[model samples]
Target: MYNLRRFILKHHFVILFILLEVISILLLARSQNFHRNRLVSGTNVVVGNIHEMGSDVGGYFHLRQANKQLAEENALLRKQISVVTDTATNTYTLLDHDTIYEYIPARVVNNSTGMANNYIVINKGKVDGIKRDMGVISSEGIVGVVTDVSLHYASVMSLLHSKSFVGVRFKNSQQLASLRWNTGNYRFGMVEDIPTHVELHKGDTVLTSSYSFIFPEDMMVGTVEDPSVSSTDALNKAEIRFATNFATLRHVYVIHNLHKPELDSLKANFLDK
Candidate 1:
């Protein structure tokens, strides 16, 4: 205790001076409005920065959930958009205003694009009203036509199939052609039988023709990537690029036209008679 007292006595002068200085600084800040305002503002800025940093860290942890929600929402919007566009384009000749086409939404269970005869399988079938010869489409464009149907699953002949043939017509010029895929690349195909005289341009929209009983008229098929007239003859050909990427197909819709049966019956009866 005597040693502590001696030490305090030795340093009391300096300690007192430090205490007085701290008091003086406090008095100066309290009396000076500008200094007090500056101090408060500086402290608030530091605290705000700290709170922002904490919030950023918390938000980082929630990103995965937010991203998944966004993806699901985007997928739903794409589905709605596809339906509207298909309805607007393909409802060209609905004689029966009562006719209603039903679309059964399905997810792609299996798909193949690297092979010569590619196919796709969906998670829906007869129970879901998905029948054979129904047209299947993705958000971007046509995917294929249903070829086989089971109780709960259906197989589709993808546009990437070697023997796949689709009736397509140019949007502006109304030039009809046949779209076929013979290569492994699902991004593009060839449109044949477009006359050399037909006016065509790059990026022209190609849609389904009404000649087929399977798909409704004017369903989007692809876009013209390059149009070239045959050098040897008067014929013309177009290289079409499909909008739907077969390799990335996830969701699709199976379209069943309500007027197909009546139309087929009339045509069959006429041919027979």
Candidate 2:
């Protein structure tokens, strides 16, 4: 108690001066309309800044949730669009007929585009009706083919894989070609078996062919980047800029064809012969 009293006595003047200054400022602010308004305005400014900062911090934390929600919405829209497009193109098919293809939305858990045989793993598998050889696609375009499936996960052979080949055709000229990764580039793939007679252009769209049972017909694969005649007189080769950026892939849809079993069975019997 004695030490406390001595400390207070030593700084008494400074403490009194601070108290008096605070009281004077309060009195002045209350007595003068301009000062009162300025004080309120300054307080409001500080509070508003604090509120904005808090909101920004909260929003930053919610970004991943927002993105996942957006991806789910997009997956639904894509399924609807694919169904509508297919219906419009079908001539003999009934309007009320069951859809030939179904899309199962999934998140990519792991991905690699740099390897010679790049593969992707998604957070859906046998339990989600994902099967081996099912086609995978992103919102932009074709992604890959499912090769293995567990109850809760699936592995995909990405288009960037050296062994990957997709049947594709030019949208403008309808010239059929095969797309294959050469392990030389990530953004581009090689379109092979393009007929020499077909007029080649730099920007022609390459799309999935109807012959592919794995992918829906007319799905985008890529756009031609460069075209050149191959050493063989029969064929030409072109570089294609991939429609889907595998490096940025986050969500994908697995395509299940209802008629795939029948087709596979027929192929198997034919192959046995």
Candidate 3:
């Protein structure tokens, strides 16, 4: 206690000066309008900056939730679009009047684009109504077909796989082609079976054909690029810039076709006969 008292006594002048300076500043800020306004403005600036930083941090954490919400919205929009298009075109109408395809929102838990047979794993599976042969897509375009499903997860055969073949048609000429991954580029695939006589040009849009039971008709696949005639002179092929960037895929929707089973059963019986 004696040593503490001595130490305080030795520094009393300096301590007193600091305290007086603080008080003087406070008094000046309170008495002067300019000083008071400056202090308030400074406080507001600091507070505003802090609040903005907090908001940015909070938004960063909510990104996944936002993405899920967006996926759901997209699914709803897609369904609505299909209904509208079908009604306008007077396409096939069912007795039940329900949309032929329903979308189940899911997140891509795993994905591979750097392999011969790349597959995607989604967070939803059998429990979520995901089944084998279901179509998977993102907001941009068609992704793949569901090949396997578990209780809580499903695997998709990505369009980038070598074995993948999707029936696609040109948007302008309606020329049909088979889309397949060429195993050479991730950003591009090959469109084959287009006749040499059919008109094709670079940047022509390719879309899912009506013949594909997996994907809804007219879903975008890619744009035509580097079109060429095969050596056989009987067929034409073109490179397509895929619409979906598989490397950065995140959210996807699993498509459930209500009439798929009935259609498959009918086809099976006919084939057997």
Candidate 4:
């Protein structure tokens, strides 16, 4: 208390000067509207600058999450490019006017790959016209499909899931098969039921087959990391390294085929017979 009083006495003159300056400014502002407006404007500018700096600091702290989101979006775009390339290269069946598969772009708002039943949440929903069963893809490759939705958000069954299955085929042969992840590797999976007769090679691209409505023909899935056959097995299985980087997934495009419902209804009716 003694030190505090001593310090205040020491700076008393300077404190009085600052108080008088503030009082004078307040009187001038009260007497002149222009002066008051100018003071307020200057204060606003300083406050805005301070707010911007604080926001930038916060954003810097969130870079990891932001980067992950960007990675997912990039993966979706890669999937689109692969689809176009496959369709153009004569390796995939080109969709005519009657084809059903389509694409809808979306951003990943929530995602988790560490769970037993992993799922991805996108920022698109019924309001965005996203429906269940539509294929979800990224620039890297196929992410999954829209499973559930609300007004502005939808859930996706990521391709990394053990239960997830989609029609897939070798790029060159176009032979159709089911593709699934067995939790063995995040970036690689085994392409099953590849016929032993079809010439197999390493580094060959694999894509979605035309038979599946969930994905358009030629949508990229992965590349053949290893092509090998068991000595006693009659079929070949290729170790496929997925093009889509699930670890860094962000944005996804939901595929909404205009003809999907009709095609699915017809198939369902036929099966009822």
- C-alpha lDDT values of all predictions: 0.75, 0.79, 0.78, 0.73
Against the hidden true structure, what lDDT does model 2 obtain? 0.79
Best of the two (1, 3) by lDDT = 3
Superposed by TM-score, candidate 4 places the C-alpha of residue 176 at a distance from the truth, in angstroms, of: 2.0
lDDT of 1 by residue, 1-273 (tens): 999999889999998999999998987567333123323321233443453455456556656854665587589889987887788786564456755577788866667788877767676767788877888987678889887766666778889877689898888988788998864577988888777788778899999897877777888888888776344656678888998877656668899888888988999999999
Task: Give per-residue CA lDDT, model 2, range 57-79, as digits (tens).
Answer: 65566579658857876798899
lDDT tens digits, residue span 24-44, model 3: 898755633312232332223
Clashing pairs in 3: none
Per-residue alpha-carbon lDDT of candidate 4 for residues 62-149, written as tens digits (9 for 90 to 100): 6797677677767977998897897778656556875555667776655666654566766667778998778888866888876666
Q: In candidate 4, which residue ranges exceed 4 Å CA deviation?
A: 1-102, 229-233
| Root-mean-square deviation (CA) per prediction | 26.4, 21.6, 21.0, 19.1
Rank list by lDDT: 2, 3, 1, 4
Where in model 1 is the C-alpha error above 4 Å? 1-97, 229-233
Off by over 4 Å in 2: 1-97, 229-233
Name the TM-score of candidate 4.
0.63
Better structure of 1 and 4 per lDDT: 1
TM-score of each: 0.64, 0.67, 0.68, 0.63
